[model samples]
Target: MTTQTLDGVTVNTQANVYFDGKCVSHGIALADGTKKSVGVILPSTLTFNTGAPEIMECVAGSCEYKLDGTDNWVKSTPGEKFSIPGNSKFDIRVTESYHYICHFA
Candidate 1:
């Protein structure tokens, strides 16, 4: 479904799942308290994990992310999945409107 936001941004949400399914843009699934989304032009900032491990799969486009703000920035693209460790902070910047599936486990 295409959910219309007050800001005029349109997002499609499908198959809300508790453990496994497709993700949406900035929508928090009630089944899991984690945030899952296909980000667009994600600004450079720190992503701090506060719970269990989260899974991110690069479906399209690319991203340059740095782990712990110390590790070098790495380029990730399609068919790649990165595990974000819990309690660690990572910085990310999207070169385009990349599609990603983030599973908060």
Candidate 2:
């Protein structure tokens, strides 16, 4: 697997899931109204400026995130997806190293 940084965030990707020997990070939209899929490996902590404005699921690892800077962390573990509005400033604290596949519309 290889780890790369995007927008100041680190993401690790498995080498097998690539195309033409290039790392597969972003995807194209299909005619069936489906956009694409992206895989990410989050570390212990991550801070972001904007994100999806909807309920997102966490397939692996747990995350401690908060929409506001109140020291309150929203726990997001395996089988749990949290709702986060877009354009909301937030910070993510992963209790354990985690990996997830995120789908975009």
Candidate 3:
């Protein structure tokens, strides 16, 4: 199921803007020290590189992502998720606003 809320989280007020404001996110930390990010992607196509493995969970809307070394674009919607490896890159395409929570794995 999609995560609707997070309790007892310490949020960073600063926004992380990317792709010239096509994407924006806020970092959050749970009581257990688990870090995550909540964000939205506007209509655009962008490539992102990862320093750590991540699980991108879609809480609303949708996006199609193509992982490095692959040609297939997988669609992720509410309650769905995709994984990306560390040191790898992925291409994401969105036609509308896509809301997500990024989980580090």
Candidate 4:
């Protein structure tokens, strides 16, 4: 694992980075043991499945997402966030490089 101190909090990066060509993310464990991921999604439309509830905070660029059971796509930009339920799927479309921090709980 790799470790880095951000804003005085040390985060331990998981050894296996998650990627599927369109997006890449590194899992991190916060000092308080919270699991999270910081990642960039390349310009593409992708579907993702989650095992736990997630709160995604956008840090750069923007993205449009349609949550499970929703037909409308919500737009989110920097400083914005969206939540997804556990054991569900969501679709996201990014026009540019989108950076985000995902908090898993």
- Supply the global lDDT for candidate 1: 0.57
Pairs that collide, model 4: none
What lDDT does candidate 3 reach at residue 35? 99
Could you give the C-alpha RMSD of every candidate to the true structure, in order shown?
A: 9.9, 9.8, 0.6, 4.7
Error of 4 at 99 (Å): 0.3
How does each model score on TM-score?
0.56, 0.56, 0.98, 0.84
Q: Please list the C-alpha lDDT of all candidates, in the order they appear.
A: 0.57, 0.52, 0.96, 0.80
lDDT of 3 by residue, 1-105 (tens): 889998999999999999999999999999999999999999999999999999999999999999999999999999999999999999999997899999998
Query: How much is the lDDT of residue 52 in candidate 1?
Result: 67
* Model 4 lDDT tens row, 42-69: 9999898989999888888889999999
Model 2 over residues 41-85: C-alpha lDDT tens digits? 445455555465545456655667777647787677676756556
lDDT of 1 at 2: 24
Per-residue lDDT value at 6 in model 1: 25
Q: After superposition, how far is residue 98 of candidate 4 from its true place, in Å?
A: 0.8
| List of clashing residue pairs for candidate 3 | none
Which prediction has the highest TM-score against the true structure?
Answer: 3
Residue range 7-104, candidate 1, lDDT tens digits = 33333455333212222255444433445555444433334444667777777777877777576888878778777788776667765655666667
Model 4 vs. true fold: TM: 0.84
